[model samples]
Target: MTDDVTTLAWAYLSRVAEPPCDEIATLVGEVGPLEASHRVAAAEVSDALRERTAARRDIHAAEADLNLLERRGGRLITPDSDEWPTFAFTGFGGAAVRERPQGRPPLVLWAIGPARLDEVAERSAAIVGTRACSSYGEHVAAELANGLAEREVAVVSGGAYGIDGVAHRAALAADGPTVAVLAGGIDVLYPAGHSSLLHRISNAGLLLTEYPPGVRPARHRFLTRNRLVAALGAATVVVEAGVRSGAANTAAWARALGRVVCAVPGPVTSASSMGCHVLLRGGAELVTRADEVVELVGRAGEFADEEPRPTGPLDGLSDAEKQVYEALPARGVRSADEIAVASGLAPTAVLGPLAMLEIAGLARRDDGCWRLVRTSP
Candidate 1:
């Protein structure tokens, strides 16, 4: 449990400094959240920190924000809270990640849900893609999300349309937990169309954000939000994306944070999959199925996809056997000489393979002719 003063201080910091406030973050880490709030309020911080807090430092909304949050049935999750995902966010403190505008971990999170944030994130994966997704993309996203849910991996994603919607719906359908990291305030669902979906998530899973209540979403906030989504999951999977999409941005953050990045390949002609192809070409792991994702993100040796093998009847046959099989018609019979001509094999060569095919049940002999056997429906 987090103390009231600490929560208030973090709430104030979250509102005043905006997000990814590296200077303020450093101040908080050094003096603690409560004291850092006091220092910033009294103008006792460094020049950089002062500049960051100069505008909104006078706005004391911590108490009011807390009141509104409580009214909305939400709570503030601070670093001191046991539910805070300390391990998941460890990468945000890295020197390389800190320099970027969207790299820093949130000062505090406003969340509404029943599940513990830390527990849900322990074995989670982020599934992201374009809003303008194709049907093929939708099918793949649903399958991946459903499989992940069945395996007890929480699905983390932005609660938007298209791929995000499909992922959440699939997870819910599977009766699994999910987290929606939003750009706007936790109470303010940005896309009005997803209100029902977002509400269900708040009841069953989690709705998290760095912004205080009543804050509307902006374009820049979405980019800032991507970092949290990337940090929460052990791996980030992109089902589909345009060349320059928010999904791609999230994938970049995942890579920067040293998280596994996986991309699903789509048709070369699909404009929606251009970004995933670009990622694949640039060294992202190619993930076609959910098992492959589990192998990459799950515990070591806990999961491994079986190597795909050829399933065709002629898979292990010699060239002559395959030619003979191919030459045999399904609807009618062919004499050995005709099969030989059709297979481009000598008459003598066709007889031996025909006998082998018959013994293997791949071919059926009728009087003096042969035809392919339909082994499966």
Candidate 2:
């Protein structure tokens, strides 16, 4: 019975334009309440010869494919299946799958993974961003994935270049579960270069798609794919992106779906940072470090000790010295130019404070500039 429903649902999805979900719901009096059989019979299918001809062709093709899959003993999962993700029982999932003039979700999600659907939901977090990411962007993504893995958080991302690749690699290196939601078929590896990464994810994590096996990615498909990423994650983080990049689209989707949206701040001069800046301006939480992400996930206790310590000697320092100390990062060497930029002070103005900080043992100079040194506990 489940298999029959799956087949019928898949057939109906393949034949119709994304059904106008609201209209269908109004007709049925509840979202996703219309059965596949009912949908097929009630389609206000046009009688025009060309329209009818196309519909018939699509229906025939879907039926033929279903028969072949059944004959081959392939499994199918419908919304009624126990394995259906719990989110699917909510209005969000209904909205995702309902027919819209734009499109519909796959009637049956074809999946192969070590973790069950619910487990995927439990641990997932979407890490999305531009394909052309800067080195800093890559570093941020890797570090975030590493932190998430340490906490047993599952990393979810599109299997694209730049930030996506880094996120997946970090998760794999950490031996944590990860999932790559594809714009194409489970069998088709888009971009070709990430074939190894894709294979590793399938073996170690999960690889999923709305499209059936053997379908290649198309331009429009990626936009549609973003919704799935948003749906799957409890939150979405944009590591780095351009003003108009696809990451913004994914972030928007996350917001629409009521998922937490996070943006990692970068050098303001970087073009890739523009999207993140915009997101921050629009109320996305600003994340500068990995613990910020953990905190955003409400696991603050997991990272409370990782918080940045007070910059420098708070004892007996003048106001100016305190200001300079406060501006320095807890660790890492910095050149004078970098320190000046960070402190928002001229190099000349900073020298006095630097001398004070060094004498007070609140900071130390290495190479050319200053670094905030932690006092003994």
Instruction: Give the top-scoring candidate (lDDT).
Output: 1
Each prediction's number of clashing residue pairs: 0, 2
Clashes of 2: 2
Among all windows of ten consecutive residues in candidate 1, which has the lowest summed lDDT?
300-309
| TM-score of every model versus the real structure | 0.77, 0.66
Candidate 1 C-alpha lDDT tens digits along 130-186: 999999999999999999999998999999899999999999999999999999987
Cα RMSDs of all predictions?
A: 12.2, 10.7
**Residue pairs whose backbone atoms clash in candidate 1:** none
Q: How close is candidate 1 to the true structure, as a TM-score?
A: 0.77
TM-score of 2: 0.66
What's the distance in Å from true for residue 198, model 2? 1.2
